[model samples]
Target: MQKNLLFYEKVNKRFILFLALVCFSGVLFAQNKTITGKVVTNESDSSLEGVTVKVKGSATSTMTGKDGSFSISAPANATLVISSVGFLSQEVAVKNQSNIIVKLATDQQSLQQVVVVGYGTVKRKDVTGAISSVTAAQIAKVPVTTLDQALQGRAAGVQVINNDAS
Candidate 1:
């Protein structure tokens, strides 16, 4: 019976040690960190509100405040993806840094691709007006000073008349 007790004591000691090691490892491997940053527009140098700041490869995310400031809890080595409408998306690496500043450029492709009508702007495919487009090549062929002269024969239902009869 004494030998059995000794064996049980050894097993209990090992179990206690294993539990302690697991707890210690949990403390060591904990990598959650608070990251703070500001997002701004590159062209205007103004704060970009409502920007989505997300930790890449994770579900952690937040939106910027009205002053373009944001704070998020993420892993130490995670990448942050910042995005907003009418601006380019940016990815910044945390790399143990506490504070960061992100500047997003304007997305010209998306901006110039939109068609502005009298009421609201619409995409190229969503335009429902009697719209006409003039290409640069067609403009280059015409050596006119004014747009009315350049578009004399280019668009349908458009009349170009000289006010001075010149």
Candidate 2:
């Protein structure tokens, strides 16, 4: 009788622990919130597809659908970052916001810029150093499978050494 009572007490304690774990899981699920939004171009007033949407201070991110719609689940009061090429970046406050519409202004000046030098990027007007531009058409004229092979003898100062000897 003493052994049976001890066994029952152990089972009861496990059952109580299981119930507490289930309740905690339920509360955690309830705390999750959903954020949905649309990304559009400010100038054209058109949907911008393939825009990356990320939760600020977190690694959670999602891409906009073909129609520029996106939905993501996160905790409440989270901040969000919306970014895309050729558009101004935007950060939004997500507190109490279930549905949002974001308008990204066009970065007209950045579209015409060029990257120069090895360590820095400069606009066309701000470049004080001599710059050489390489185009895809010049690279396509070479009969090579890899870009490094195509780059050979194309740029005056550029050097590409092939290390694949195997």
Candidate 3:
């Protein structure tokens, strides 16, 4: 009957309108750009790995690679928030730049403070290699390429002799 045909036509028209609206909404939401950047230490300029890079006001986020590089998709004007343990968080506006460099300073307070909120038990007999532990502060005092070289004379009973003494 014509009534059934009219109802089917109305449904078809509504389906086409719904599809067009969905597509228009997608365009209005805007396309994001691929942004890339490197995060480094402000003082030493060394690249930092495992730093979290996130777009402000959005859940999009990524972590830097071993080379301290990151790629993320975000709106051109979005701001990037970079953070890492023991380092101060920083925010940089994208400003339509495809590539950017972010420098983060060491948060002295973060390094100095400890949570002091953990409890664990370890039997001495169950533990091994308790000779000595090396702290990062001590290692930083020495200037050497290899950690073994840096640790030379730093820890008791720890000796590192280069086999190739050329």
Better by TM-score, candidate 3 or 2:
2
Poorly placed runs, candidate 3 (over 4 Å): 1-29, 114-166
Best prediction by TM-score: 1
Weakest lDDT window of 10 consecutive positions for candidate 1: 124-133
Give candidate 2's TM-score.
0.59
Query: What would the TM-scores of all predictions be?
Result: 0.59, 0.59, 0.54
- Candidate 1, residues 1-166, lDDT tens digits: the string is 9999999999999999999999899878887899999999998889989999999988989999999999999888899999987788999999999999999998878666767564588886455456777788999899898876887989798677766765
Ranking under TM-score, best-scoring first? 1, 2, 3
Instruction: Put down candidate 3 lDDT per residue, 1-166, tens digits, no spaces.
Output: 9999999999999999999999899888876999998999999999999999999999999999999999999998899999987788999999999999999998887455433211554433334333355679989988888876987887687677767776
What residue runs in model 1 are displaced by over 4 Å at the alpha carbon?
1-12, 116-166
The lDDT values for all models are: 0.88, 0.86, 0.85
lDDT of 1 at 33: 92
Residue 77 displacement (Å), model 1: 2.0
Positional deviation of 64 in candidate 3, in angstroms? 0.2
TM-score between model 1 and native: 0.59
Candidates sorted on lDDT, descending: 1, 2, 3
How many clashing pairs in candidate 1? 0
